[model samples]
Target: MSSDKKVRQATATVTELILETFRLNGRLIEAGDELVRPLELTSARWQVLGAMDRSAVPLPVASIARNMGLSRQAVQRLAKELEKGGLVRFAKNPHHERARLVTMTEKGRAAFAAAMAKQAPWAEALAEGLSPDLLSEALAVLRALRVKLEGHDG
Candidate 1:
């Protein structure tokens, strides 16, 4: 086959995979929402908490949004709600006067921990037949796609 034909076939396969990924993302969010319900957390709130929990120090809302592939305004709104619920707090950013940093509170940490506990079993069940190697390979592919998407965002 010609190189052009091969490229077209690869593009079509990737397009189908991307569409399926979107469907899977929606389902995963729904499942995550259920998993964090015990902590009175929605998937959106849990996402913000998880981001902060993973960070060693506080992060600006824009940083969090970029890390999570979300809009800065959306993250700011969620941060406000999280703060009102005592799950997170904002502190002055020494580097930036206007952009305060967001940090998870003790309550947020507890909720995140609870959610993680629930996640362990859920993930294990979902990975029952999937090989670790296969998952890692899939992750690499997805990461490459994410990088490509971000590159085009500008």
Candidate 2:
């Protein structure tokens, strides 16, 4: 096969992979919405809480935004809701004068844990019958591609 044809095939495969991935992710997010509704947390807010909860130390708002690939303003808004819910605390950052630290409260941790537990069965169901080795390879490739593409306008 010509190199040009191979390149075109690879591009088409990548595009389809991305589109299908997004479609799958959209449904997952919708599921998250339903799961978190009782806790009065949006799916996005839950994501933030989960991130903070898993972090070893408090993350500054800017760092949270960067880690989540969201804008600072978006993180700030979510911080407000998390604060109102008593799911997160905003503390003064020792290093950054203007940036406040964001961390999940104990309640937030428990809530996130529960939410994850609820989702795990679904994830397992979806991932069932897939080869672990193949899945690992695909994940590694996607992770590399994501890092490479990060911050670059597509």
Cα-based TM-score, every candidate: 0.95, 0.89
Off by over 4 Å in 1: 152-154
Put down candidate 1 lDDT per residue, 26-135, tens digits, no spaces.
99999998888878999999998888887887899999998898999999999999999999899999999999999888988888899989999999999999999999
lDDT per residue as tens, model 2, 52-139: 8767889987888888878989999999888888888888999998888987888888888887887788779878999999999989
lDDT of 2: 0.85
Q: What TM-score does model 1 achieve against the real structure? A: 0.95
- Model 2 misplaced stretches (Cα beyond 4 Å): 151-154
